[model samples]
Target: MTTTVETIRKGRKFDQVLEGARQVFMADGFEGASVDDIARAANVSKATLYSYFPDKRFLFMEVATTECQRQSRDALDSIDMEAEPREVLLQTGQHFLRFITSKFGQQIFRICVAESDRFPELGQKFYSSGPAVFRAEMAAYFEQAEARGQLHIEDRILAVDQFGELCKADVWPRLMFGMTKVVTTAEIDRVVEGAVETFMARYGV
Candidate 1:
């Protein structure tokens, strides 16, 4: 049976294995990480680790996905979909900016980029578990806004992507390439406000 993140969260053994896998993968890249190290670190037998995750790659995928889900849930928890568009977008954008610049986020992102060529599927897994999920959620928010006549979006998917790009402007590109590590809260606010303004200008009915 495919292990869900919820199952891993609820099961102490599964959580142990996931924590061990995360630590090992962080210390040693995916290719260099060994199951023996994970089993030992987790204090579980090989059978226990294998029961939760069938292979190293699968374990990495599940761990990364679970982390992404946790971050997304935490960041987006305060967003009130029923709130004013400007407030909602501002809150969401700031949360996103903070998340991507966080230490854990940066580490996971670098790992995905560094190992992408060797483990192409890992990159795909990261995208599916992270950006794609966020985009879909944003699209749903746009659909709700349209229903309330707050926005007139002819193409919600495109709007979602466009808004995200706007929100990340001057932040993600610089941070991702290591041009600068400190994206001040003020800078994030400026970017998010500008994006919200532009988005509302185009979509607000």
Candidate 2:
């Protein structure tokens, strides 16, 4: 009986437990979210919860990974990848900023950071699933755009990273540092537009 991530996902109550954990984690964060509370939230006994996830860290990682995959899929799907570079970057920037400034996004980041010292793997897993995967997807798009003569990116990886940072500029930091609690649509648009402009200034053909 190998109770790995794959096996855990196959459990009948996997989604239920994941949802319950996500709710609790969002509310209380990793350090504060107790197993007892998670089980109660899922309407399952502690034993049942453990049966699906032997460790709390595993559960948290699963929640973060699953959410990241879903977010990436949804965001990419909504964007017209075949559009002009400016339009594509604009849409991608908007989606990126919107998510990173979101409550769930912030929570996921905080959990990874807060638990990093004790469990380095937590941060690693989050980065791999979230940022790393995202960067790769962006790079693939940039390469295609370059081939189409829509952009001229000598270093796709660096360009992708820069674009991400540009999107984060003010909104992401303010939210992360408690400088602002709310981000209006105007703010998202402003930042995303700036990101696209800067990115295109360097890469647009």
Candidate 3:
């Protein structure tokens, strides 16, 4: 029987290993990261690390997926669900813009794309944990807003997707295309506020 990565048993040091992997992956690209370095960084033996993760790809995928999930969850937690549609959307758009334009997020995206041919699962994991998670959260919020008559949306999912695309208008493409290295606060604010305004104009009640 083949041992799947998911079947690996996570001991008490599971979180410790994940934290260590995240640090190393951030400092070094996926191809540059080594198991020995990961083990040393995690303060775990090679045996222990192997016990938890059979392969380096699996470890990297878990780290990326976990970080994406945490980012979305943290952003959702900070949002005021009861706030007016414009206020809530502004907050959400800001969070989305800042995170996607961050160094870690960019690295994860690049790594997933670069390694996709060899490891298609990495990209799938990233999408499910990042974009899909964000869409689901935003969809729920849109449903709530519609219920309160703050938004008139015939398709909540489509609106959620549109809002995401709107938030990515300028800054995200610039960063992705290597036209800009640093995402200024001003840029984030510009894109986020524009997205909110566009969304509210279309959907606000």
Candidate 2 Cα outliers beyond 4 Å, as residue runs: 1-10, 23-37, 54-57
lDDT of 1 by residue, 93-201 (tens): 8888777776656766776777676666667877887778878888898898888989998888999888888988988888888899788989988999999999999
If ranked by TM-score, best first, what sequence of candidates would result? 3, 2, 1
**lDDT scores in order:** 0.79, 0.85, 0.85
Question: Residues 130-203, candidate 3, lDDT per residue (tens digit)?
Answer: 77978987888889888988899999999998998998997888899999999988988898899989988898
Quote model 2's TM-score: 0.85
Query: Per-residue lDDT for 38-113 in model 2, tens only?
Result: 9999999999999988878779888888788888889888998888898988888888888878777777788778
Better of 1 and 3 by lDDT: 3
Model 1 is weakest, by summed lDDT over 10 consecutive residues, at 2-11
Candidate 1 vs candidate 2: the lDDT winner is: 2
